[model samples]
Target: MAGVFMISDHHFGHKSIIDFESRPFADADEMTETMIDRWNAVVGKDDKVFHLGDFSFLNREKTTAIVSRLNGYKTLILGNHDRGRSRAWWLETGFQEVSEYPIVYGGFFFLSHEPMYMNKHMPYVNIHGHIHGQKYEGNHYFNVCVEHWDYTPVAFEEIVRRVVPSEEQ
Candidate 1:
């Protein structure tokens, strides 16, 4: 089976995201190319990538072009920005699946486009995105946004390391 990965808030083709998020890029093209390269470096053809949301701000053709170049079997957890577009539109861009609601994965993580409320008392961790730079102040809340994760898809093992105490590993 392919490795599982997660990421969010790529904001591709959006020039304002560079300034808004303080991304270190000369331009949108640079950001896009660099992000694609980084993604391809870590993800393989058979890898499964769960993109939590705010994937791109580009039109259909442009978005399709970007998605086609990335390595992975992709799934999108639709975010606020992902709204208004039809599911068919997203699937046409090459995503294997698209979801507007939170998905519980591995029986221990709640994956969502926006951060879900989480506490230590809860049985599962909330792995999410949406807040670009702001920190989620809880051990049970893991932010998978690009800004927090060096603009690359993170491996499931890494998330496990973060959420599982060393003693339990």
Candidate 2:
């Protein structure tokens, strides 16, 4: 079986990635191409990729076209800035939206986006996006990278290190 993978917050076609996020690319087109190249490098034809959110900065047509070219069966968790059009388009392009997927996979809980507040929560870490590396720091919760420029999968162990207490580790 092919390996499973997850990534998010690519924000393709968004020129702000370079300016706002200080990404390496110079423009949205360049950034989009770079991300695609990186994703294809590690993802196989059969891999399962859970895209946390903000897949594109463009409209549904352009975003869906890009998604079609990428390898793997993709799933999306709607981000705060997501346009409903994109989600509707994704349904036709072999992508599903994870409203509240509750299943154990590889010994972890897979959440699309992290909730703001919770009284009781699952023992497993919530793999999510909206918050990148720096944003995750100091917070008790954990979030995985959606824009995996290298298509690298972050393990639950790494997240646990930050979110879980030392005593638990």
Candidate 3:
């Protein structure tokens, strides 16, 4: 079945991220292509993908071309680094939807580029990215950063299973 997936911090065309994140790639070009390959490997042409943030640092033409090469219907939740262009620009670049702020999903999950304050008592889970390589210690927080997920998009069902307590399972 086609699935809903999530991932973040692609940082396409940003060479320094390879060093900053200690990614196992030779350069930005390699990093970008490898991520694209991994993305296409798991995502189908009809899948829906929510990109949490920091999608890319490349110019509009390059970014759009990259998006065209990937599978799935993409949606963007603006990240700190995504401010260089407006929401319309992102939409024009191939993201079907672009959000300026965090959004609620499935009535119980908070989706955002950055982690929101969530606790077990709050009746909500935060599925987010942006603190790559680091994570908040709690069941209510789920980090979808590629750095934490083998540089692949994670299935939404997988995230939901994590939010469901062991006792319930």
Candidate 4:
């Protein structure tokens, strides 16, 4: 069966991101290729992939090329870096959907490119990206950036695993 997955901050074709993120790649090309490989290795063509944000730094052609090589039905939520391109442009480059703001998923998870403020009073878990390695210290927050998930997509089942155990404990 197809699965659902989430990931963020790929920074594809951005050479500086390698040094900035301490990525294992020697350069942007290596990072991009390796990430594509990793994505395809796990995601099936029919899988649903929510790429939280900051998907790439390349031009339309390059971005489309990378997206074509990957496996999954992809959706993009804009991040700060992704805002430079119009939503239509992202669609042209192969993302099935692009949202300019946060969206609620599973009725309780708030999905966005940046972390949302949540307190105990709130009834939602915010699943977000863009902070790279900074995690909010509460069960109400989850970071899906590549840095936190071995530079690959975090499965929906895995997200449930984390949330379920926390609630049970």
Off by over 4 Å in 2: 93-107, 115-122, 137-140, 146-169
Evaluated at residue 58, the lDDT of candidate 2 is 80
Candidate 1's clash total is: 0
Q: What is the TM-score of each candidate against the true structure?
A: 0.96, 0.74, 0.96, 0.95
All models, RMSD in angstroms? 1.0, 3.9, 1.2, 1.6
Clashes of each: 0, 3, 0, 0
Q: Give the lowest summed-lDDT range of ten residues in model 2.
A: 147-156
lDDT of each: 0.92, 0.63, 0.92, 0.90
TM-score of 2: 0.74
Which candidate, 1 or 2, has the higher lDDT?
A: 1
lDDT of 3 by residue, 50-150 (tens): 99999999989999999999899999999989977899989988999999998888888889998997756897889999999998987889999999998
Better candidate by lDDT, 2 or 3: 3
Task: Point out the worst 10-residue segment of candidate 4 by lDDT.
Answer: 160-169
lDDT digits (tens) for residues 56-143 of candidate 2: 7786678777877788777677766564544456676557544333334566555665434332444555566776544443343455
**Where is model 3 more than 4 Å wrong at Cα?**
166-169
Rank candidates, TM-score, best first: 1, 3, 4, 2
